[model samples]
Target: MGKGGESIPDEEWERFLREAEAGVEGAPEEPSARARMVARRLREESGRPEPWRGHPPARRQRGKGWYAFGLLVAAALLVVALDPGLVAGWFGGGGGDGGSAPLAVESKRPDQPPPTEAAARRPTVGQPFRGSPAAQWGDGTAGIGLPEARATGWMDKGQVAQALEKSRDFLVASSLDPGVLRGERPRKAIALINPHQRDVQDYLATAFRAPSRENDPVLLFSRFDRTKVRLVGDVVKTRGRITYREGKRGAVEVTTDVTYVYPAVRAAAGSDEVVRTIVRREVVMSWDDPAKVITEPGTFSLVSYKADTTNGGCATPTGYFTPEFGPERAASHPADGAEVDPYDRSKSMETRMREAGGAGCGTATRS
Candidate 1:
């Protein structure tokens, strides 16, 4: 008993909508039994003869209430099939402002599958590290930056070489004292070390303490001396031997011995001082078993460093008068094929040093 003569209840209207929406394109074409009965009653009430002669009509005539109910059901279903939003609004499912939200019909592309956990966890290898080029650079050299080595497949001798190359490049870039002062060099370089090694952590911590309290000079210079030095422009040669040691509890130790031919030069009082140094480092990496790769941090940490230098490698330079001073004796000299005077100047220091037959200042010693 709504504004209309007789209105369908809210519950019945909702049911009609659900049914219509479920089978909008598959509704039966013929009228329902109730509808047919109602039609017969209308014909009988109007005093029209039945289509079937002689005997009474096949279906009993329905009351006006049944007729009204059947017509209402058909009308509600038709309206729902035509416009679901209007029915939803009529059932109080619309917004408070007398509007209804559109039906959210889901559609997915046929070829694309849903994402999975494994796909999300795929390793990012062979991809370049994207960051500020300056942040990646070692010792301010253009194009020389942090390592691009990511965890790919299993670790092998070749992969170890790539990691060693990153360390060596860091060293070459750190020849300038200014690069060491940047502080990022140590942080980035330490990323290679396994964080589980307390000894390595202690060593790095001791080396990078207060400005005057640090010990490891070869790794980080104790003082920022104006000694313009650069590694000689020669192919860095490396000889490594990989050793695997098995232990109890399924732990395996993978060790490597790497020897590097490091030639370098430092400016000393208008003369190019050649310093030939060879570094033999031992790296101990850990793996789960024979088949597993050691991808943990500090697995490739440097456990031992033995640097042999030809000149001024062990002692600090002595100043005659002011702070700006060089070594007393120019004794350490470069190897035969190494470059002595690579820096551009009016006169080449290499010529003068070569004529002098090996010029070096102090005895080269290990740090």
Candidate 2:
């Protein structure tokens, strides 16, 4: 047995037996980690620890003395088997049952205890766990695709957190950039999106297209018209954490609790009408890439997204967006024609909000 499975000391063994026979206090809480291992080994070696039911009726009269002697012999054999040094001492060897002397077993063995959770979760180069004190990326800062992240290790828990952060930044920038919204810089902002995140792509596309019906959600923001509303103040501030787990088939599911804040406007009307909208969004990012390494701009996709408009008078929707989990709606506006749903079979931002609003979601009015 390994050092961790070392035999219990004679005094501890006796005390344990005494307490166990008394039926008052149970065995001492496995003393230490190594002692816990020893306890497990004892169970394996001595069979079950159930009380002896005397040898059938044949040995019913075997005196208590014989029973006690039998137990002592069994304990001695267990000690000799677990610690050869104790057997050596029985024959006048210096090292015996003395607590001061070390066990005759080797201190180190080829098989050591299993890796601890912390050791298993230690972050790799380039992929530092977010805010982890133990993480040490070559550069003070660690980010996706940075030179330091080019390590050979697999992704850790921290990488998932970083990926969510990167994903959020990409989504916000793409939504705010007029060039990307209009077809001018289409692929530029979406470079970080996982290829499989088709629903996310469709969602962004339909959000900026021309409005089809009354209270068109896109109209609330100049319909991606930079001349109408200019993005001002700081970018969206995210306040939330992501929860992730290894999924079936080796996939990873990351749930994000995010709140987004941005200034929307009615610039074309010649009025400085800007409303700060705070949206609480819950979405899932699922990755199914076979690539060896996933960097900041790697293959991670937005599996699903649901956003609720919290700011009242914002004129945006307040319900679910993805058709897979919610309703269905569309639009068609060909450049000059005004009303255009960014994609087919998807709900408008307002439409989603309306659905959620019907469900009793809270509302926040603009100041």
Candidate 3:
């Protein structure tokens, strides 16, 4: 005899206890769906009003098995009520699958400040790149490390290696060289390009001598106006990757995707505020096989170039980048396109270019 005038045979009760004990000892870390459902049902039934409560006792005497069963149900319900996370874990709501786990109620505290606020609070006088992600990046040309070169269908391993080395040199000259950054001609970089590509050379000359909105040298090289801003430190933080693949006409095409972070302050004596300009560039250079393609023997030809500059004035018609210091300065050259996260390099340059449409000013989500 059990509660509510229910009767359970002694043999069935003994079998139930044996099975329950085995389940308790051999259960997996995470409960299965059936186990969760059973636990949930037990919890719900324990909460319901008992029909036999306060009624006259049944004719049959209650057995010890009934009390044991009641105790097991009470214990399970207590555990489920006390630790909600236990229930969540049973239903895949916990962080068992590499997701963030639910924090205990007692462990939670007040929210901290936002990332922007924390960044703004950091000092910049002696630590120009302190709060920036570029702080951990490589300095100058060291970041432009080449990948392992292998022989492709178009070129031998030695040729591929030379082409990669030349591509690295071009990257260092165009982006990391101090003279190039200060609006000087990237002579070394230009010399590496194929001389037969007269149009590119002509464009570079025009871009340097007289820059216009159409032929801005900043598109290919990273430069800043020396008259307005001075570099904070000798080190320019840089990081990115270089890759090569076989192209049409038996040419080995090397592609460089690099980002440079330059920290600067106004040249004026009183200005101690440090501002950073981030430039991300993707350039494609091709080494043409002399027999298969009509190109310079040792030099590479520039196929395409694209760049995105963050913290630069929007649509400024100068060869050098004009860094925006604050809201007052940014207001003068208002950005007009989608917000960009300059530090995020997960997407390719082509994808970003497509998202950006043609050349127009875009707001930087951060510096």
For all candidates, the clash counts are: 19, 12, 0
- Candidate 1 lDDT over 1-367, as tens digits, reads 3344465466855554566668767654554444366567767685665543147533545466678899999999998777654465466453212232322221211133111111111111111111111111112222222223334334455554465464544344433233442223345546655675677778767654532212453433212323544443433323333444443334444444333333334434543433334333344544433344334733443444332222323333321001111353434343433332211112222332444344233222221
Model 1 C-alpha RMSD vs. true structure (Å) is 26.6
Q: What are the TM-scores, per candidate, against the unseen true structure?
A: 0.32, 0.36, 0.65
* Model 1 ranges off by over 4 Å: 1-184, 210-226, 247-249, 268-273, 288-312, 316-367
Candidate 2 TM-score to native: 0.36
The list of candidate 2 runs beyond 4 A from truth reads: 1-154, 157-162, 175-189, 196-224, 235-237, 264-274, 289-297, 310-367
TM-score of 1: 0.32
* Residue 50 lDDT, candidate 1, scale 0-100: 54
Model 3, range 1-367, lDDT digits (tens) per residue? 4556566565765565566768866535554444455567667785654442147456454556688889999998997777654454466443221112322221111133112312222326576765555554666766665788899757889878888888888888888888988878888888888888889989988998888877888888878888998888788877677887888787888888888888888878878888888898999988887787667766888899988888765655688888867665656544556677787776778877777766777777766
Best-to-worst order by lDDT is 3, 2, 1
Global Cα lDDT for candidate 1:
0.37
**C-alpha local distance difference test of each model:** 0.37, 0.40, 0.72
